[model samples]
Structures are given as C-alpha cells and as structure tokens.
Target: MRLNGKLAIVTAAASGMGRAGVARFVREGAKVAAIDISAEALEGVVAEFGADTVTGIRADLLNPDDATGSIDQAVEWLGGADILWAHAGMPGPASVENLDLDAYRKAIDLNITSAALGAGRVAQHMRKRGGGSIIFTSSVSGLVGSMMSPIYSAAKWGVVGLTKSLALALAGDGIRVNVVCPGLADTPMKTGFTGRSGDPAEAAANEAKLIANVPMGRLVQAGEIADAALWLASDEASFVTGVALPVDGGFTAR
Candidate 1:
C-alpha cells in the first residue's frame, strides 16, 4: 500500500485519467475526495468505490469559487490532504484559423488557471500537515509543438512552467509539485478531439497519423498516466519535484 493512511483530492474525477487516479489511490489504501463538475458521474464513482474510500465532490474547476471550495470541502472531509491531482483540462480549437479569443481564454483557464488556484489553496492546507504532493496534467503537446492546436500547446506549456515555479516556491514548505505530459492517450478526450472532423473517415485518418508518430505504435492508456500520477503522489517520489515527466512513448524524444 504505497499510500496507506493518506488522503487525496483528485479533480476531473468522473472519467479518464482522473477517475483512474481515484481508483488507483483507493486501491493503494488512500481515502480520496473525487471532485468533478458532473454530480451524476461523481455519484457513480462513489458508488463504485464505496463511500468509505471515495467522497464525490461536485465543483467546476473553471470557477474560482468552486475550485477553492472543492479543496476546502475535500480537506474538511478527509481531515487533511496529502495529495492533489489537478487533472481537469480540455482541448482547444484544432487550428489557429479556427481559434476564437473567448475559446483561447477558456483553454488557458481550464488548463492553467484552475491548476494555479487549486495548488495555491491546497498548498496552504498541505503546509499545515508539514508537506504534500501536487500533480498537474499536461500533454505531449506541451513539450513539443502541436500543429493541430497551438493554443492548447501553449496552455499546456504554461502548466509545465507553473509546476517548476511552484515547486521552488513551495519546496521550503516541504511540498512537491510536478506535471505529467502524456502522449496521444486512448481516452474519450482523444476520440472526441479527433472526431471533431465530423467525418468518420477523416477522424480515423487523423488518429492514424498521430499514432504513426509514437514509437510504441499505439495510444497511451489512461491507466498508464494514472500509474505515473500514483508514483508522483506516493512516498516513492518523496525526493522528486519540479519535474515535467513525459509519459509520451518517445513522441517528444523525436
């Protein structure tokens, strides 16, 4: 039990990597507050994991009030938090020509602002507990350029920068901050993004093109990213901080 006796808060916990993180953390003996904007989906998580191990929190990370309130509520329920996986994020318009200023701002808000607010709020609670770990979800696009969506690439890059800056500022408080940059993951988010072409043939072609770049020759599973998060959140990574760890199957290596 890598996380025995620990308590954690995971945002976007209703699905994908965030939901996987909740399941993995609980299996490792940690009680978790599963925060998501979807109350119905969150209920499903609590039901699946049992109330003893998972507490479902409904909050919109894009809203500052909801973001901070979710952390406060998680701390209240868990007694204290030892880990925070701020994994809520979204893909922006596929091309710069399609970009709208409002959409661009929303991308930044979802990818970076929410992370900053959550980390700040969680750090205060963690400092009282002596130390804790904070993890953010970036993308392979963060490490390299995304010809499809430069805005998303830029926002994710901001996340990596934020992780390093926060790591230094919070180190004296014994808190560790890190980000995970996953390569073309096999998740609904990926499917939906590719499907935006609105033509099944084109969508499949797009996916194939992206996968052709991965040296592993396949999409990275959501669970694999969750596993990386588990390592960062557990005592196994006690000495690790300020790292933008890429679980990108050699995409960035190219």
Candidate 2:
C-alpha cells in the first residue's frame, strides 16, 4: 500500500524475483509495465494481472532499442513512471577455462550493458518528474568471488558498481538508486548456479548446507526479496540511496 498511486516499470518481470516484485507492486496499488524476454511468460502475467494494472512487454534487454523502449512504454502506459526495477540479467553457465567468447559477451550484454543503459535513461525521466526510485538487482555473488560461476559473479559485482555510481550521481536530482543483493533464493536462477543436480536426495542435502550457513537457517523466499524491493521503491525507504540492501538470511554476515 505504500506505493499507492505510483507507476512502476519492472524488467525480468516474468519470473523469480522480478515476477514477485511485479505482483507485489500491483497489489500495493502501483500500476506496472512488466517486461521480460519470454513472450509466453509475459503473456501469462498479463492474463493474471489484467491489462490495466499490469501489462506485459516481451523484449531482449540486450537490444538497446528494446531496453529504452521498455522504459518509454512504461512511462506512456502508466501515465508517468515513479519506480523502476532494473532487474533483467542472464546467468549463462560458462567456466573461465572453457568459456566461449560469444557466451562471455552475451553475459556482458545482458547484465552490464543493458542495466547501464536503463539506469541512465530511466533516471533522466524520473529526475525530470521531480523524484523517483530505481532499484538494481545485484546478488551475493556480486559481493564475493564465486569461482563456480565467474561470468555471473563478475557481472553482478559490476551491477553494484553501477548502482553505487548512479545513486551518487543522481542524488542531487531527487532520484534515488539502490541495489538489492539476494542470497541463495529459491528461484530458477538457483539451479544454474552450481549446475542442476539430478539426484533428489543430494540436491536436498545441498540446499540444507546452503541454509546452514545463513544465520536465519533458511533460504530467502522470492517474496522476501520482493518485499525489500517494495520498500526501496516505496516512500518508506525515503532518505535511502546508493546502498546495497541484502536479504540473504545473513549469508553475508559471516
């Protein structure tokens, strides 16, 4: 309810944290334009949320045009956007030793390039409107070196840098920027983190170990991440910017 009367644009809006954020935003009374790369998933969200409160746009953020276009349409459709969740990113499995040049570039395109473009462009609009909030989805990988997924971790770390600089630069303009670092959340992205395990028992054991490290003794739920996202995008987090808020169940505490 904190976002009542605001309009939000959420990228990666078809699934996981992004999907949860879109739903939370709408439920909190914010109209949202949900963008995702999957046409099928996007259509499904539109069907569930209806066209008025939440609409869907399927586009690859790697395409510069589409990245900017998502912002434009959201601004247009919702009558002016006050919140932007720059959440589109890819987690391609590539080892440093065997990583293909193409895959590495694709990671850069999706994670770093697209996020930078959206941050700059969306900030311009939000600034002109007097004020707004933008939250970038970073990760626990961004905080520490994860050899298991070098490309993804590196890209997420870059997101922290992007969010930090953007927040500092836009502070004067009344536009707030921040980053959310989620730790070991149960999302599709989780499976790819260490490669999918075929054995059910081993996978459960692995999951348990991950939770053991967290002080909270549980993996973060997507809604928990969404709620953090919601507060950052809401007036409740006023005076907050340029910080990476971790909803990691204390994974980073140790």
On TM-score, the candidate that comes out on top is 1
Model 1 regions more than 4 Å off: none
**TM-score of each candidate structure, all chains considered together:** 0.98, 0.93
Overall local distance difference test of candidate 2? 0.86
Q: Candidate 1 — what's its lDDT? A: 0.93
Error of 2 at 26 (Å): 0.9
lDDT per residue as tens, model 2, 25-143: 99999999999999999998999999878988888898999988888877878778799998877776548787688888888889888888887788878877898998998888899
- The TM-score, computed over Cα atoms with residue i paired to residue i, of candidate 1 is 0.98
Segments in model 2 whose C-alpha atoms lie over 4 Å from true places: 196-209
Query: What tens digits encode model 1's per-residue C-alpha lDDT throughout 47-116?
Result: 9999988999999888999989999999999999999999999987777775688888888898899999
Native-to-model Cα distance after best TM-score fit, residue 77 in candidate 1, in Å:
0.6
Superposed Cα RMSD, model 2: 1.8
Report the error of model 2 at residue 171, Å: 0.7
